[model samples]
Target: MKYGVYLRPKPERAISGDAYTIREAEGSVLLGLADGLGSGEEAARASRLAVACIEEHASLPLVEILQRCHFALRNTRGVVLGLLRVDLQAGQVRYAGVGNIGIYALTREPFHPISYNGIVGYRLPRVHEFVAPYHPGDLFVLYSDGVNGAFHGNEALLRTEEDPQEIAGTIARLYGRPDDDVSVLVAR
Candidate 1:
């Protein structure tokens, strides 16, 4: 799979409160994005903790992984997180998320997967896992709430962009808010 990531902090902040992880293990690709409850150091810590949990438990089931993240983040500021596991051998994608993180599938049949409303550590709603077939040329985009959700309208750019890095950079540059931490991850 080809993938790219872009991350930036609010203009006045020294570090972004957003964190992400991409890992390949046991015929699957694990992708995760976390936005801490707010910006700056504490938020960054929360997000980092979430991503670390994901990396440490990449082999677990989606729900289990998230559950671990929830337990691990209890003392922190909490975070909104999105997790996707692309099962290459099974030709399917399994995803679970909580809060405003957006996951967009730009494939022959495009669709947006739903995320439950809640924060990971503070108040987690019942988790639901969404599954979708993975095609050869499918593109998956995940971003934090700091990114403008309306950017999905640029399907042409998303579909045709050769470099995944360019796609991620463009989206963050055009749609990301300067007052919040921004993160975008693109994988195909």
Candidate 2:
């Protein structure tokens, strides 16, 4: 899978509390995003820790990875997390998420994965797993709640074979606000 990510802090802050990572793991690709409880260094630490833990345990099941993140983050301010694993060859996508992070399959008929209500580290119920079809040209997009909920990029952009970075940047530019940190990630 080809993917790109973009993140920015609130206008008044020098750093953002949101963190994300995309990497190949075993036979699938792993995409993880975390948004700390607030905007600041502590929040950044929480998000960084969540993403780091996810990266380290990329081989584990989605539930196990979420469990590890919860345990690892017990000492800090909690974060909302979304994790996705895509096996292109197998035409499958496995996902698990908590809180408001958004995950969508940007095909002709878009698919939005519903994240359960909970915070990753502090308060969470039994995490649920979701599955979706994985197609070569289809785009999968994820973002923090900071991004404007109403901002969906031009359909033509998705139709073209544009670079993932371009798509992410475009979304961030159009929907990102000055009042909060924002992050946009796109995978194709």
Candidate 3:
């Protein structure tokens, strides 16, 4: 798998309220992105906690991992999280998300996966996991709301970019909002 990640804080802040994790485990590649409730230090803390929870429970089902994050972040500002598991051996990708995080798949039959509403630690709705076939050259992008959703319109860039890192950087640079923390993760 090839993947890249980019993160940036709000213009005036020294810390970002978004965090992401990518790990290869048990024949699957785990990808996660979390955005804390608000900006600044407390927000950053919540997002970090969410990512840590995902890492600790990397072996669990996607819904269960988010549940664990809910429990782990109850005392903090809470967060919005998105999780994706690419099972290379199984040739499928499974995803679960809460709140505004975005997940886009670039493949022969591309589609947008749905994310449920609510905050992770504060008010989680029933979690729904989506599974889709994974092809060898398929690419997936997950981004925080801080990046404009319209960036997805640039299918040419997403398809033509050779390096995942450059795709991530280009998306953030062009669509990131200065008023909010931004994060983008690209995987192929």
Candidate 4:
């Protein structure tokens, strides 16, 4: 599978409040994104911390990593978290998330994955894992709220054969908000 990402800080802030990490194991890949509660350096710090935790424990279960993130982030500003793991050998995806990060699976059909309502580290709700069928060419998009939430499964965007980076960039440029830090990650 291939993956790509694009990010931009809120125009008004010196640093973006969003952070992300990607990890690949022997037969699976893991991706995570964190969005701090507000914009600026402090928020960036919080999100970075969350990403660091995710990267450090990529070998663990998604829920375990998130649970660890909750504990790791208790002292700082809280953040919204999203986690995705693709089992290449099994041709499936396992997903778990909290807060407003937008996630969508674009295959021959479009479907929105469930994200529980809560904030990581502050008020996390019960975490539930979701499993979905994945194919070689399936497109999965995970984005922060700074990017427009409405473009869940835009066919024009998902159907293109462009590189993942180009796809991420186009969406970030076209749908990102200037008042908030934005990030878009594309994976197959």
Candidate 5:
């Protein structure tokens, strides 16, 4: 399977504490987005550590990765994380999230956001899982909490186009607030 990824990290409130990464491997895509507690260098560090944890175990199961991160961040400031694992050949999408992660599968119609609860490194232990729908031309989009008030871009462009970076940039550029850090991932 082939894919594209685009990301733009910004420091909105003079602190800028968000980090993300999207990796496409042999059979799956490892996508992670995190918001480190508050703002400042500490926040950035938390976000970075969260993403690094996910990348380190990119080969593991979704639950295993989440569990590892949960343990690793126990002593840190913690972060809100969204993890997506896509099986290209199996035609499946797996979601395990803690905190503000807006995820969707856009086809001809847009659906409700996936149910996510808890905060990594925080006291919230709510962990939920969902199986996302994967279609031939369906686009999967995920964003951080800073993207709460995004413009969302054109569903048409997302469906007709295959470039995830452009789509992510368009969404970030148009929707991201000046006082916010926007990180996005688009997959089809």
Candidate 6:
């Protein structure tokens, strides 16, 4: 099954805060979301750096891929990471992230948030690998920073939406705050 992706970020002057991307191939798929530390270029920079590594190493070992990213950002301000890896043939998904980046898995439930352990920056330990089984119709939602005006960042839509990219575009156009970056990606 092919996955749909969506994204929404706050702010109009500059996209700072949220970063995300989706890559679907024959047997492999990758979804990434990053939240820069603050608003403006700083947040955008951090988010860009975080997702860049994930996109670059989609085929690498999950643990190593994250470690390399963590190390790459060691000299800069910390950022958050929300990533999803799907093996189409295997019917499995590996979900992970740090900081405020979030994940919502849509199974039978409506909104399910998959929590992560630590923050991505400076001297943090590598994240533990977490794997979950996936079905064809399952929905995955990824969000960055504080979505629009809501505190605690934005939320993900796993249960309700069928078109991830459309959902992402809609969210960006609808609730995006005048200040801050908002990006969303949905896949299933």
- Choose 2 or 6, whichever is better by TM-score: 2
Clashing pairs in 3: none
| Residues forming the 10-long window of minimal summed lDDT in candidate 6 | 149-158
Off by more than 4 A, model 4: 108-111
> Who is ahead in lDDT, 4 or 5?
4
Instruction: Name the lDDT value of residue 126 in candidate 1.
Output: 90
lDDT of 2 by residue, 1-188 (tens): 78889999988888899999887956689999999999999999999999999989988999899999999999999999999888877978888999999877775444567778888889886987887777777788889998876655567765668899998888888878769999988998
Q: What lDDT does candidate 6 reach at residue 121?
A: 66
Worst 10 residues of 2 by lDDT: 104-113
Q: Sorted on TM-score, highest at the top, how do the candidates line up?
A: 3, 1, 4, 2, 5, 6
lDDT (10s digit) by residue, model 1, range 102-183: 9988865545588899998899889979888887788899999999988888877887858888999999999998788899
Score residue 68 of candidate 6 by CA lDDT. 76
Separate clash counts for every candidate: 0, 0, 0, 0, 0, 20
lDDT value, candidate 5, whole model: 0.71
- Total clashes, candidate 6? 20
Assess each prediction's global lDDT (C-alpha) against the native.
Answer: 0.90, 0.86, 0.91, 0.88, 0.71, 0.65
Query: What are the runs in model 5 whose C-alpha is more than 4 Å off?
Result: 1-15, 108-115, 149-153
- Tens-place lDDT per residue, model 5, 1-188, is 23444444454455467777777888777777788877678878888888899899888887677788888888889888877777777867777777776776665444444635677876556566667555566677777766644444565656666477677777777777656666677777
> Comparing 1 and 3 by lDDT, which wins?
3
Worst 10 contiguous positions by lDDT, candidate 5:
1-10
After best superposition, candidate 4 residue 140: deviation in angstroms? 0.5
lDDT of 1: 0.90
RMSD of 2: 1.6
lDDT of 3 at 124: 91
Candidate 4 weakest lDDT stretch, 10 residues: 104-113
The residue pairs found clashing in candidate 2 are none
By TM-score, the better pick of 3 and 5 is 3
C-alpha lDDT of candidate 2 relative to the true structure: 0.86
What's the lDDT of the predicted structure labeled candidate 6?
A: 0.65
The residue-by-residue lDDT of candidate 3 on 1-188, one tens digit each, is 99989999989999999999998977899999999988899999999999999999999999999999999999998999999999999998999999999888887655568889999999999998998888888999999999997877898888885899999999999998888999999998
